[model samples]
Target: MSADNEIVELKSHNSNFILNIFTDDYKKAIDNIKQKFERGSLLKDISVINSINAKDLNIIDIQRIKDFLKTELNIDYKEKKIIKKNTKEPKKEILKENIPKVVKADILEDDNYKTKIIKSPLRSGASVSYDGNILVIGDVNAGAELIASGSIIVLGVLRGFANAGAKGDKKAMVIANKIVATQLRIAEFIAIPPKDDKKSYSGVQMALIKEKGIEIQQVN
Candidate 1:
């Protein structure tokens, strides 16, 4: 198979992290998974992983990979059923006729496994936690807390405790229009602004993990 055909695609939907395996070869699938792990491209905090296109694999092969993933990476594995279209039906032809089309409204729903948006400000004593990114439309007042497995973005000032990359993703960042947070954290690293520090920053600011530490920088 070509290199592109051997690649594995990972996607998240409704709290399920799905791995789409293109090739049915067991060895190639294992190698591809290992490569992704080594490159730190996989999410380690997810409890379950759903595999697509794995129906052709035998029971033994499936069990082997399941054990490897659960034992080595602490991630559960499941094979999803493939939905196939009916191939025995004949094609139908449509006559050239004018028909009125029905228009429907498209309802947008929030996917809890992806980013979550908060429309109101976080008052003191308020706490929020999510498995994915978080977008806050208002200020995060002091004594409030925000924790996310992914990144966190604040449209207003962030003055409370905010922890991004709570699942240990070092690449995640925390961004805000103005940040004077009591404490900021990315992955396992934490940075607390001095109590006496009263410096103001201009424009949007971002805090990310750099050299095993959290660094705050102004975003242009």
Candidate 2:
């Protein structure tokens, strides 16, 4: 299973430990915690963890885990509240009301900006190039190539080569339902998947430029 799907993952930040719980399987979680303590992997210097981040667990389950930790190992930790990202749609009327009279102006669509949508799957040896955004409705088989000046969005699996921001737009992003791509590029940066990687993913994923380089993350 992927790390994201693991029952628990322990990480340290600024010398403080944090327990990240991914599932509500109380027994499995407790077993994993026991193993960690038995192996002296996480607890060596401190008896307290900073907090527990359990987004997928309920209050009862969380309390049960906390009780188990306190009673079994005498360890104590805080429960960190999950803060969800805001995703509300912006209201146009509110925007207009807040705009200054001097700054009022018409918003015109960019005539030069375009998006290309393909309805068919890209087979091996197939090559597609678009000056603007590219959207593929089907899977991109290995050996296929896609180049776009803007962003690239694949509705199905992407196992080929994809180059976005071909004109050097560092802000461009690539998204796919399932990305097992051999290679991905955005602007001057490139990312190649590890050889013989057997990890499986369950959700949509995205690749974008980050401070360190191209970063792939599950799209929530």
Best by TM-score: 1
- Using Cα atoms with residue i matched to residue i, what is each candidate's TM-score against the true structure? 0.48, 0.48
- Which window of ten consecutive residues has the lowest lDDT sum in model 1? 99-108
Clash tally, candidates in order: 0, 0
**What is model 1's C-alpha RMSD?**
16.3
Instruction: Give stretches of model 2 more than 4 Å off.
Output: 1-112, 195-202
Query: Across residues 5-100, which tens digit of lDDT does each residue of candidate 1 receive?
Result: 655767787666777666667777878887787776446556677654465554335445655676777776543434566545433323232211
Candidate 1 yields a Cα-based lDDT of: 0.67
Which 10-residue window in model 2 sums to the lowest lDDT? 101-110
lDDT of 1 at 76: 60
Off by over 4 Å in 1: 1-113, 194-201
lDDT of each: 0.67, 0.69
Clashing pairs in 1: none
